[model samples]
Target: MKQNKLIGLGVATMAAFLLLSVNTAEAARTDMVDVSNHNGYMNVSDWTGMRDKYGVKSMVTKISEGTFYKDYTAANNIATAKQAGIYQNGYHFARYKTAAQAESEANYAATLAKQDGLPNNAVLVTDVEAAEQQYTPLTTNDYNNFIFMSTVQKYGYRTDIYTSGSWMNNIMTVKPGTGWIASYPYVVGDKQWYTGNHAWQFSSTQNFAGTTAVGNFDVSQLNDDFYTGGQNTKPVNPVTPPVTNNNQVANQDYAQTGTFTANTTVNVRSGVANNAPIVATYAPGQSLNYNHIYIVNGVVKGRYTSYSGQTRYASMGYIPGGSFGKRSAVSNSRTYTVRYGDSFWSIANRLGINMNSLAAKNGKTINSIIYPNQQLMY
Candidate 1:
């Protein structure tokens, strides 16, 4: 079955080995991988292949970040995985500094989860580590954590807290729902800091041989219940797409002004090959425009032109004709903190900005050295 290939905000690898919820051996345990849009584009078939080859059954995908930001691939990833018969959960990368903000973020995550096809019986995780480090009002995180858990519970979904011992001990006082503890030396069962934890993410630098994914994989081991597909062994998220009344125009030539409905795992490729460099990602039900369509050997395909005026392409099966068209125009004209390994070229390329113009806007050269946590206004 195709599982959700969504990953979470960076969780440091686990180092310490403790006991498991059940008495399970540590030597021969299957690991689960978490991925996000940053891990690159992957279709349902790609995720299924990963599961079949690596025995990865459970996943934690990034659905929403804060109250404003939403993962571009959350909808499709959740839908495809649930449809493919895999254990999947959704998480929000929280940026709240107060209890009210945390509650709002929780509601935001739940709303997006519902829109993205996240199952009701699955876990909804709040990534609190980032907010603990970035947000202020030191005495407010405990209340924030409490409100977050309560809000998610109100939505008829279980809440899971993903954080380290330091954050738990230093920042927050109240414990939320279930725990997804992240510490070193990969431990199982009741952790030293938190008593109730379902899984332990051991390492973030490990790579999978069965897959061709770049960068290190965030590796984790699930408790017996989680390894067994959390709550529902046969979790279902079947697609019941609304019936379209538009007449099918067979062999209709692609037009410059034509729009297409993105049906999840939709990639905007720089070229026609499956391995082509991806230009952008679109959520399911998002309406996208294309420059041309290609019919190759009974297969339907379409070309999408990027903001850099580069023509990208994708298979047309997920690119059905639609009247709800909206072209992507990235105008992230706000201050953004520079993250690790971010470069002018990479940022410009990702945001569809002209490289030289982006540098000029920052009052820096195209080759200026960017450092971590440095804010850039574009």
Candidate 2:
């Protein structure tokens, strides 16, 4: 009896020590990643396994790049994330030529957010960097940054800026509602770059297996002090996409008037698995036509582009009422302002109007180059 008791006490002591060690290790971690495609392309189906395998708690995927690009992998990744019951948000790669251009990009990105089912609560981050032109001067150039984020905010989406500290202080005058700092090689447990209002990017180009992500992706995490359980500024007025589209899509019996925006920039896989090879990518705010979104267990799922490339699926609240389940209807007589990539042809197709009638009504030549902010009646 004495021997058994002594042995039991020894085991208990060892177990306690091990538990303390584990806790200590956890305590030593100061930064975590808000995962994105910058590290590699992540598939939607891969999220759960990636989350469980890598212990990802919060993340935002790459949705748009500049005024024209969209990430194809966003729909599946976002939808699957909702199904997995995780906090998933989105970010946009900004390339603005002017303040007006900035606002246009923001509006376009917000539309993508709505299409992909990103609610007002999901933080929409603008990735400011030199896309069209490298080395944007601090003076004169930075105001566009504010325009980009402010417009996104104006549209009722929670907005953040992902830029360097020097850029935040020197390049841009007005700071974002949330500042996602990019300070690589952070020391474990040392959050010197962390401000009470900012998240830090500790590393880039890190090799993380199992995600099937391509390229060197960035790893960032929100400051524990400022993290709102990964919630963004909710919109005062949320606009939801229609549940059905007028066009009849091929192969699928049903038609949805609604389209989804790409919340993250990832590669579209051939299968609904992460291990599947990357077949394609989507640009930000690039619209996927009616009835192309996938749904599983009431959560919106993205279809393979090969099977259906034109549309992406949006997400509802993983927590319920994330976007208020509100849908925005297309106005037939409404006027749409032309922006960077606007053409009468594209506009008419987007609005389901006749191109010839639209051009004749607007007195525009078919080959005319429409400038940014130019309004046209469809």
Candidate 3:
């Protein structure tokens, strides 16, 4: 009887130990470090150090902006990151004045990636932000997104849209696809927006000095499963289906435009041009009129609607500050403090200014030396 009792006790002890191990693993999985652009410009050696020290599993880096593409640094960054054994992806900051312009930019980016050989775990992302002026046409923005996504799909690359939840739900329609939501919630009511998302930017001021990747704002965090074969898995194809109702046309509503029903199951593609393939599908009755529509390669693609209820179009022929305030003369008065790993080119890209302009603003050449915490006016 004592022998049997001893056996039973051993089994119970083993079960308890297993449970404890599982709980410990779950706790460990909760901790993640996000090395986004907030780290400024890190060279290959710098990134490799972070990967080795912090156990960084993944990274997202800026690749291009509007028509201006990053120099060899982008490819160098990706290659260095891969060598350091980290998953790497690229993002483009949208700066389209029209749908056509956006489409052109997307195509250019795809070509660059193809020419340079996309990284193994690459995810082509669209970073959408508001234009300088509020009155810019909504159609232009929508079409620009469409073409950008389309181009990405055409290149046989995964795609994702990175934006805030409010922008996704209110300003833009969330088609059937994943999103990198920038909703930082340190506590209750700190949420930036409320919506379903694949990854969440938990905080912008993470302290990583002691841990690893030091001297950078802990600017973002994501779900543990993000880029770990979960919903945040890099999209195999970023394109949505093509708009099926090519023949359906509606008048521009000056007020609130009621949602337009998709006459047939539609494929909402990602790119602005006819390059990328379909990434997701929208069924009949799926609303498109919630936003505005713009012309892309002569076809109308629906876009986000504005507060005035009218669909906006791209300023195709207009010059900057001409009828519409599509362009802004950059103010050379403001100054920015340089951070560790920062380069003039990287700083210029982040500031949305040309390298020469940035140099000129600071009374230095593009190759002028800059140091961490040094202020440069632009």
Top lDDT: which candidate number?
A: 1
Worst 10 residues of 2 by lDDT: 1-10
Better of 1 and 3 by TM-score: 1
Off by over 4 Å in 1: 1-30, 131-139, 173-177, 185-196, 212-215, 224-378
lDDT per residue, candidate 2, 80-168, as tens digits?
67775557678887778777888888898888887777656677887764533235566656677777777888767777776665456
Candidate 3 TM-score over all chains jointly:
0.45
Identify the candidate with maximal TM-score: 1
Compared to the true structure, candidate 2 yields what TM-score?
0.47
Cα error of candidate 2 at position 377, Å:
91
lDDT of 1 by residue, 1-378 (tens): 012211323333434331211132333233455666765554565456445434457777788877788888777777766665557787788778777788899999998888888777677887776734445554677667778878988877777777655555555543443566655444332333333556666555544432334555565556546433444322122221222223323343444335566655455556554445566766777755555665332224567555454666654441111111233333436555677878888877765668898889889998888899988876
Residue 288 of model 2, lDDT score: 38
lDDT of 3 by residue, 1-378 (tens): 100111111111101111111112111111223343445545555554343323345666666667875535466656666675566666676667676787887887777766555554367777775452123555555566777787788777677776654566444544643677554433412233323454555444433221224463323334434443343432121112233334433322222223334434444444433233444544644443323333342233444322232333321100000011111222327667788888878877765668898888788998889998899886
Clashes of each: 14, 32, 29
For candidate 1, the clash count comes to 14
